[model samples]
Target chain A: MFEHFPQRVLVNEVVTRDGFQSEAEFVPTATKIELINALSTQGLNKIEVTSFVSPRAVPNLRDAEEVVTALNRNTDTTYVALVPNERGCGRALALDLDEINLVMSVSETHNLANMRMTCAQSLDQFARISAMTAGSAMRLNGSLATAFGCPFEGLQTEDTVLHYIEAYLEQGLHSITLADTTGMAVPNQVYSLCRAVRARWPDLEVTLHFHNTRGLGLSNVLAALAAGMNQFDASLGGLGGCPFAPGATGNICTEDLVHMLAEMQLDCGVDLAGLLTQSRQLEAIVGHPLPGQINKAGLRTDTRPVPESVTQLRQSLEA
Target chain B: MFEHFPQRVLVNEVVTRDGFQSEAEFVPTATKIELINALSTQGLNKIEVTSFVSPRAVPNLRDAEEVVTALNRNTDTTYVALVPNERGCGRALALDLDEINLVMSVSETHNLANMRMTCAQSLDQFARISAMTAGSAMRLNGSLATAFGCPFEGLQTEDTVLHYIEAYLEQGLHSITLADTTGMAVPNQVYSLCRAVRARWPDLEVTLHFHNTRGLGLSNVLAALAAGMNQFDASLGGLGGCPFAPGATGNICTEDLVHMLAEMQLDCGVDLAGLLTQSRQLEAIVGHPLPGQINKAGLRTDTRPVPESVTQLRQSLEA
Candidate 1:
């Protein structure tokens, strides 16, 4: 199993977008830019800066353009933004972003509830956006939300998920992400679906987006890794969730994911200590505790001095 | 990977001893018995009822005798207790315990810190206890703490861990548990160790005890399951930790573990709903928020009514 894992994995930090979008309080644009800048210095290859969505729908990311435009762009980091539709794409095109992530739910019920559109309508919208971005330097990545399971529709069949993947490929989207938007994925389901996807599209750059809602986030990551997945989307401090999806919780924490990968000796490029520092900063900015464990527990390398009581007890026992 | 897992697994609840010991307040003896009685009804095959230790060492469990004697034991549940020395074994022997679990740290540093004894002395004490229990009806089991890693000693080599296993076997104890006492076991390490143990002792009843301190508890369970481990130790609400190990946290939550197993279609012979209910009751008794995710998120089977906004949005889209 150890030999089966990739020697190095790609971690795409989505804190600025996915981590902040669910915040009830609108995070300051300067703070968002500072986070992005801090993350860029930590050697993160990809940072999702913000989402270009209707302010009424997601007011937290209303200043998406300002956040993206104000970034001290690091040449080494690929800046990405979430684009919900062609309008969002138009807004993203006005800025300098390395990638535009387009998302749609695989379940029609979720799609209707979240986007006020059917799955087919969402696909049509994605096609329009894909065409609009054709020949542009910005990369287009499609995310199939609720691909594993949905709260409203229950478990999704492999065929249902495969259909959306096929549609994304047909739209000429080379980068696709399978998202467990409702935190309903198990390791077996993750492994089986990822294996099937890898078998069909051997060259596709597949990424996984998992929620720690039910506490199986890291397990699903390990499952996907076993299934040959190399790219994953994680939020700093385990922030963000789907506003429309009932019971949806935070995404897998970027620091926690990096900590686990580092412990496993898998190279993830991003510095774990730097990521933890950012998690602390985000926690302070959010004005509450964040869900990431490493930030609270400290790293395994952290060796605290032995307490005096224990030393005294040992000495007493020796005597 | 799913095919590699057993069709059914065994879940042993250890909230009484492992979970309650770490509580800052002593849960009332009557409440402890009530919780144990409730857990018994949940179809859990085994429950670690309490630890037989000095009151000075663990004042929380000072009423171990009272609690065990008052339990409304279910015929279907096997009651177990943690015994640290010969005196503990004597106390457990007086009760109608189904098993006595003897614990010692594999790391000399941790053994000195936690048990106030060296590894050799602890082994000798376990031997004396084993002798006292010879020809008794109750089963004797040994748990090697810090089997995965130690806070004071770092990662224990496989040879050192295997040596402790050999010593336990020589003590005429076939029922053995390997514990990640400090939550330091990664999936690869768990897989490798479980695989090695299974290969060495085909018929040995091996149980794994994991802590979720680093948020890899369930992932380690998945890894162990893939390596053919069938039995695990979990607490009701992710309670319990080693007071001696810095950064040590809760044991894997029984409800969360069962939820993951049921979602994966693996049978653990435990009712998740019943466990969740008991977790709620335990939470109220503890007077604080517990770490179990299922208690807060509700089970996946729990389907919430669709929000009115989603219905209105769908109707408007149709119009």
Candidate 2:
């Protein structure tokens, strides 16, 4: 039944790297690896294992190299890592990563706040890094941060976002992502951006990285789907929040997203039950309730009769 | 600018009754009143205050009559109470509710499982109740439960749901709500049901009630919106779940729904910030976290530069 449907859904798991990085408590390396390997069983096409930022800046992902090197990568699954600069690129390169994602903000205010550099300077740096990775086995992807709307600037225009994309493409990057880092991208903005991007660059492999900050994450996904873009980056249980961005919310809940896709009669190729079990494990490891809905409330496949159970429990309690 | 939008979104708050009833613990009656009053200030047009069910069945709502009687009853807002039978109707009538919503399942199996009676018996009861309520000032709204799909029976036909609506109309109840009780609804199901129901009853006021069980709640809302159904029932922070039907998730999050409506430039007349504050307060009163997203991240409102005091504190922390 599912084979006839086009493979329009691509889930990118960021649980290990993005989810754990925001935590004040340290997650052991073994737990991080366990989470990544468990995610592979759910048939994810890509998994963002870690970021190669300086250890001093983000202590949680200091073991980025070890996590990436130890991944049980299948032939179909592509393992990617975030690289912020030249030093970060060196770490990813040493691990023989499948893809290295480079990010720069479109909003000047956010660009300075997040990367501590002017927009032009970040572009220049990406150009240098793009040159270094060209023709190598590893693919380079440029991420346009704050491309939807900026917390400081209020709204980032399509023209400004396009200019940055053009620059990235001019530097020979094969893939690009428009990220709503602060979850400011509404459905209208997402629809317009996806249409314009595909219209502007028909062959560009556009991936969307959205946050559920204002609850527009999945709706934004629908908008992107309507615009014919498929690839998405999500965290299981919506676990991650940007540490630097104040009031930033969780990533799109992976199970929720998969459930939506599966019922829409779209081919997501994910085991919803397996993902729910993994989410419960994630909640246990994190030592707090994770923000996923499907894990707490199992799917239609879980057909345990309720009133009988409730009656027996009530009778037991009363007795 | 928002006043000109063709679609005026209406959010019916279902937290006080649906949300609290799902919890095992009893929420203090005073807290329920406070939450409803707070929601009134958030520009919600309607609030489903409490259900007048037998106290023995749902002990959480033992004080339903008292809670309904104490509502603020603001002139601009409509207060609704759920009445399951004539006994429940007597209690609701004493409270002089603005609207009395009568709920019955569309599927025969669910009607038997949920209300412990056949569909014919429920309709006969509704006919008698409609006669009793004929000349009253209170508006009677008949809700067709499990209109989309049911846990007991897999899927409900559009013909069956429309038949129930027609029966309610014959019994003089013009307002109707189509409920996806188990969240087994998809966009196609919503579109078909709305089209069929609207075609039969041209002037009927139809509301769509969806659970986020399969993560299609908001997407189903969009489908209903596309088919011209504007009113929706949502719980604060998506807090409601079905006790009779296990695996049934909570209602759509009110803040998340309002945020989407507002961002799409639709006029919901809801105060987003005030709703967020109430969500946080609701979280505290319930002594648990919520599924609300907009509250954790502020709206797309323009952010001011960091105050010098906070900047100094941030700098100190970095140092």
Which candidate leads in TM-score? 1
Q: What is the C-alpha lDDT of each candidate?
A: 0.86, 0.80
TM-score of the B chain in model 1?
Answer: 0.96
| Candidate DockQ scores, in order | 0.53, 0.36
lDDT of 2 at B297: 64
TM-score of each: 0.97, 0.88
Off by over 4 Å in 2: A1-7, A244-249, A306-319, B1-6, B23-38, B64-72, B244-249, B302-319
Estimate the overall C-alpha local distance difference test score of candidate 1: 0.86
* Candidate 1 runs further than 4 Å off: A242-249, A309-319, B242-249, B312-319
Per-candidate clashes come to: 0, 0
> Residue A236 of candidate 2: its Cα lDDT?
93
Every model: Cα RMSD to truth: 1.8, 4.9
